[model samples]
Target: MDAANLDRLVDTDRVHRSVYTDPAIFELEMERIWGRAWIFVGHESQVAEAGQYFATTIGRQPVMMTRDEAGGLHVLFNRCAHKGARLVGEGAGRADKAIRCCYHGWRFGLDGRLLSIPMADGYDGTRFGKGCPEADVQPLSRAESYRGFVFASLAAEGPGLVAWLGGAASSIDNMVDRAPGGDLEVTGGVLRFEHDSNWKFFVENLNDLMHPMVVHQSSSLTARDVAKAELGPEATMPPALQIIAPFTESYRFFDEMGLHAFEWGHGYSGGKTSIHAKYSDVPEYNAAMEAAYGPERVAEIFAVNRHNTVFYPSATIKGPIQTMRIVKPLAVDRTVIESWTFRLKGAPDELLRRSILYCNLINSSANLVGPDDQEAYRRQQQGLRAEGAEWVAMHRDLGREEDLGEGHLYAKGSSDLAFRNQFRAWKRYMAGVA
Candidate 1:
């Protein structure tokens, strides 16, 4: 599609339905957006030891993150050099001494260099050999990690990951700082789920603050009712109620939480507070934080309580909860999401346990909360098939976003400002503007 056509599909306050429903546009996004954007791969802790590898995809392109013997980290094309068979299966595994392709005995080192091609004497005259760099498993264009969270981009020439992250970088910083020792690790595995709709639906919904009270009424109301019935008014709230019941928060509560929008379609909601703010603090974890950073610094860190930071077109993270969900697009109408929970080093295990509980309660495929959102996405995918509505409106508080003189814009949490800011960056990417 040309620049003009992509421009027509997006506007300051609304977007054409085709942006979410078109196969051609999805392809363009895979190229122009996901292709160049700094997509999160996996955390470095997942491959802390040598020869361990984490397998993931960048916009349907199979890629692997491997740690070498000397602790060098490389993100490479998962395909083997010889006939292009994928070297590792999905998920994490140790490559052992070297990656040996099953189709042919093509062996490659963890650093992506060709080690040996079996029966090499048979092809002495041909170009296929260990000496050629083309025989090695090729690396991605660029890969960088921030505080152990590895992100790779297919495009080599762009802003460095830090510059590209803009204000959204704070979410990551705060997440790592939450750890008393300033470290985090992916633990308890990941919860994999699928959405039978466009990937954009999930990212946009991350900070589309108006939908939680409405879309999650059934689950949240059920939880709220059960909590009131099961526990005394003076009783301490249980972990389960602390999580699921937050969806019933008043519109005023969410609106006061505020929303932040940054460049490159990256932003987060709830700088001062969030649904997570009311979670009963784990005293052990708080003590550890206070011990590590002292009371004043800990208070300063906790004061910036944010929610649902979107890296955009690929992943969304909840820093307060220490959970990240990765978006993997399978087709125009199919998307897979993986939720990974983290452990804050030097904090008590109860903190990690709570993080896992939040992950499962909200992001698990079989859970009450995620399915509600998934069903809504499914209906949206099914409904947009109609020609009745040509455009999706995003006009709430259209001109009300505040230029905070910081690095990004802010607005009332309930406004559609987040969506408008998102599509503006979307146009820049899909239209090939800088």
Candidate 2:
């Protein structure tokens, strides 16, 4: 699509249906947006040991992150240098010795340096020489880690990870601080789920606070009812129920909580308190945090609670609860979501257990919460296929977003400002502006 056509796909209040349903536009998004953006790859803890590797993708580029024998981290294309076959398998494992291609036995090091080729004496006189750059697996343009979270950008010429993260970087800080050692690791494996809708739909929903009450009403109320029945309808609601029950929060509560839109399409919602503050705190975990960071700093950290923070085009992080969900867009109508829970290093075991419970209850495929939103996304995808509807509305409090200076905007929680902010970032990316 041309620049003019891409520009017309999004407007101030709504976006054209083609952005979600058009195969051609999806390809462009993979190229222009995902290609250049600092896409979340995997956590450093996943590849903590030397020779360990985690395979993932940026846009359509099949890539993998590997830690070498010397403790260096490298993100390289997964394809083999010889015959274009994928070198490593698509998962995390120890690839420390050397990556030997299943096809033709071509060998490469953890850093993707070509190590050996069978019958090498036969190719000595050919154009494929020993030092040829094409003989080695290709690496991505840039790879960087913030705390333990690793990210890579396919485009070389862009802002560094810190510059790219901007205000959204604080979300990472909050997540790490939850651990007494101020660190974390992805534990308990990941729950992979797919959405039969546009990837943008999933990302936009991260900070779209207005949809929970409507779309998630069924599951939320059921969870609340179950908690009431079990807890005698008088006890404080359990944390597991609190996670799902909040979907039925009043409009006034959400509106007062506030939505923050940050640069490069990153933002967050429901920042009034930590996601767990509603139920109660884990005493052991609280004591650990106080000991590590002292009373004032711990209180300050706890005060900056945000429910959902969007690192646009890739992942949504719930820092306070220590869980994250990443969107991997496979096709125009298909998207895969990988939900992960973290163990805050040095914190109590109960804290980690709570995070795991939250992940299983709300983020997992069989959860009571995810299905409700998934149903809406699937139905919306099917419905948008009709020729009748030409646009998707994002007009809630459209003109009321308050300027918060420094490329940030404050919108009432019920506002669709997050979607508008994302589309504006989308337009910039599609136009190759940054």
Candidate 3:
């Protein structure tokens, strides 16, 4: 579509229904939006040792991240140099010495160099050479990391990862600092969630505060009842209560917690208080943090409790919960979301357990909360097919948002500013602007 046509699909407040349901727009998104953004690959902890590799996709393109023998990380196209076959399948494995292809037995180094090709004499005078650039497993144009979290962008010349993060960098910093020893590692496996709707639905939902009390009222109220019944009114709150009971919180509570929007479709809600703010404290974990960073620093770190930080098209991280959900769009109407939990190294085991508990109870596909949101997304996907309404409203708390400078805009948590900000970035990207 031309610039003029794409410009009409999105407006200041509402966006066209075709932006969600059109195949052509989806194709353009896969090319312009997903292709250019710094997509989340995987955590460094997954491939800690030399020769270890984790395979994932950036948009529709298959890619892998490996820790090289020199202790450096590299993001490479999973395609084989010789026959264009996928070098490694989807998962984690060790290829310390060489990454061998099952198709033709072509071997590549951990850093993606062409190590050797079997039957060497087959191309004696040909353009194929062992160390030639084109004959090696190619790395992406740009790859960078922030506090062990890795991200790669196909476009090489845009903003670096940290600069791209802007005000949201504090969220990552707080998550890392929460560890008593100031480090994190991926643990407890991953849960893959299937969504039969546009990928934008999932990302947009990260900071959508208006839906929780309405859509998730069943699960949250049930958890509230279960908590009161099992443990009397005077008893301590259980993990399940800490995890699930917050969905029924009133709009006033969320509005006071506030929402934040940044440039490039990045934003979050609940900077001061979130569903995770009042988790039953673990004494050992708090003591460890005090020992490592002292009470003052620990207090500072604990103060910033961002509910969910969306890194735009590819990922949304729950800093206080130490979990990340990856968004992978498989087709125009299909998406697969993967939730991975993290362990705070040297902290009490209770923290890790809490992270896993959070994932299983709230974030996973079969969780009490997720399916409610997914069903809403699915209904929108199906209902948007009608030619009756052309625009989807996003006018909640529109003109009331406050600008916090440095590309940050703030509003009540119930505001639809996040959706409007996302669509603004979507329009810019569709028009080939960075």
Clashes of each: 0, 0, 0
Per-residue lDDT of 218-260 in model 1, one digit per residue for the tens? 9999888877788856677889889898887989989988999
Q: For model 2, what is the alpha-carbon lDDT of residue 291?
A: 96
Give a tens-digit lDDT track for model 2, residues 1-434: 89998888789998998899999999989989999999999999999998899998887789999998899999999998888998777778886689889989988889888888888898888888457888988899999999989999999888899988888898899899878987898886789998889898888877878777888878897778878888887788766777778778877877777899988999998676533457577888888899999999999888877878999989789988899999899999999999998989999888788888888888898898888888888888988888977999999887898997888799888899899999989999999987
* Better model by TM-score: candidate 1 vs candidate 2: 1
Question: Model 2 segments beyond 4 Å from truth?
Answer: none
Q: So what's the TM-score on candidate 3?
A: 0.98
The models' CA-based lDDT, in order, is 0.89, 0.87, 0.91
TM-score on alpha carbons, each prediction = 0.98, 0.97, 0.98
User: lDDT tens digits, residues 1-434, model 3?
Assistant: 89999999988889999999999999999999999989999999999999999999999899999988899899999999988999888978888789999998988999999888888888888888786799999999999999999999999778899998888878889999999878999995789999999999999998999889999988998888878898888887778787898889998988778889998899999977998899988999999999999999999898998899998989889999999999999887899999999999999888888999999998888899999999999999999999988999998878999998989999999899999999888988889988
TM-score of 2: 0.97
- Poorest stretch of ten by lDDT in candidate 2: 270-279
Instruction: After the best TM-score superposition of candidate 2, give how far the Cα of residue 132 lies from its true spot, in angstroms.
Output: 2.2
Q: Between candidates 1 and 3, which one is better according to TM-score? A: 3
Stretches > 4 Å off in candidate 3: none
lDDT measured at residue 384 in model 1 versus the true structure, 0 to 100 = 91
